[model samples]
Target: MTPTLSEVTVGDELPALTVPVTRADLVRYAGASGDFNPIHWNERFATEVGLPDVIAHGMLTMALAGRIVTEWAGDPGAVARYSVRFTRPVVVPDDGVGTEITVTGKVAAINEDGTVKVTITAKAADQAVLGGAQAHVRLP
Candidate 1:
């Protein structure tokens, strides 16, 4: 159910989400997004480019992180604005398990217009991967 304005409060934390990203996902994203950057699927090229291994697409990570707010609001259209800074690359190894992305969010404020601001943090391997992540969302 969508959260009401009265049910939300500043400093409230949303449930955490962990997603396992695999090499197949990168290939699919590459095909769908036309972002066939070698670094995302080629470990050799990634390491040559100064990256530890194949890294996930920044937009994919952003979308995964945004799931927290969307699921909380129970409506994708309720989101007004979302922003994030790519601070660190999420390194994905060739292992079958690949890597995991963890997302967490906290309510920063309840606006006068029945909107709420949420601060988000995305991490991989216990290291932060996104900075200044926040979302503005409308609630019922």
Candidate 2:
């Protein structure tokens, strides 16, 4: 059964999601989104631009977070609102340590319409990468 608003509390935590960031993944994302920013695909350009390495697109990371919320809600349309801030860059290394995304949510406020505003914190490799990830979800 899906979780109802009343069943969740202020400190409830969402399940974590781990995604391996690879050069190929970044390339595919760039192609799919039509965002061919050199810093995301070209190592030399990324370095010239003062980045540690080719970084994953911010939207790619946001999509991963959306996946976590969708999986928990069991319905993508159930998410009334979703947003996040990219606090850090996700670097794809040649050796591929692989990044893991963990998200936890707290019930911030419940609306009169039976929707709950959830404040989410998403982390990668134990580092907080996305903060203030908020989502308004319909109660089951």
Which segments of model 2 are wrong by more than 4 Å? none
lDDT of 1 by residue, 1-140 (tens): 67788899899999999989999999998999999999999998999989999999999999989999999999999999999999999988999999999999999998877789999999999999999999999988
* Clash pairs for candidate 2: none
Best by TM-score: 1
Candidate 1 lDDT at 88 equals 98
List the global CA lDDT of all models: 0.94, 0.79
What are the models' TM-scores? 0.97, 0.87
Pairs of residues at least 3 apart in sequence or in different chains that clash in candidate 1: none
What is the Cα root-mean-square deviation between model 2 and the actual structure? 1.8
* lDDT: worst 10-residue window of model 1: 1-10
- Tens digits of per-residue lDDT for model 2 on 39-92? 988899999989988888999988877776677778889999899988988776
By summed lDDT, the worst window of 10 consecutive residues in model 2 runs over 94-103
Off by over 4 Å in 1: none
Superposed Cα deviation of residue 112, candidate 1 (Å): 2.5
Residue 52 lDDT in model 2?
A: 88
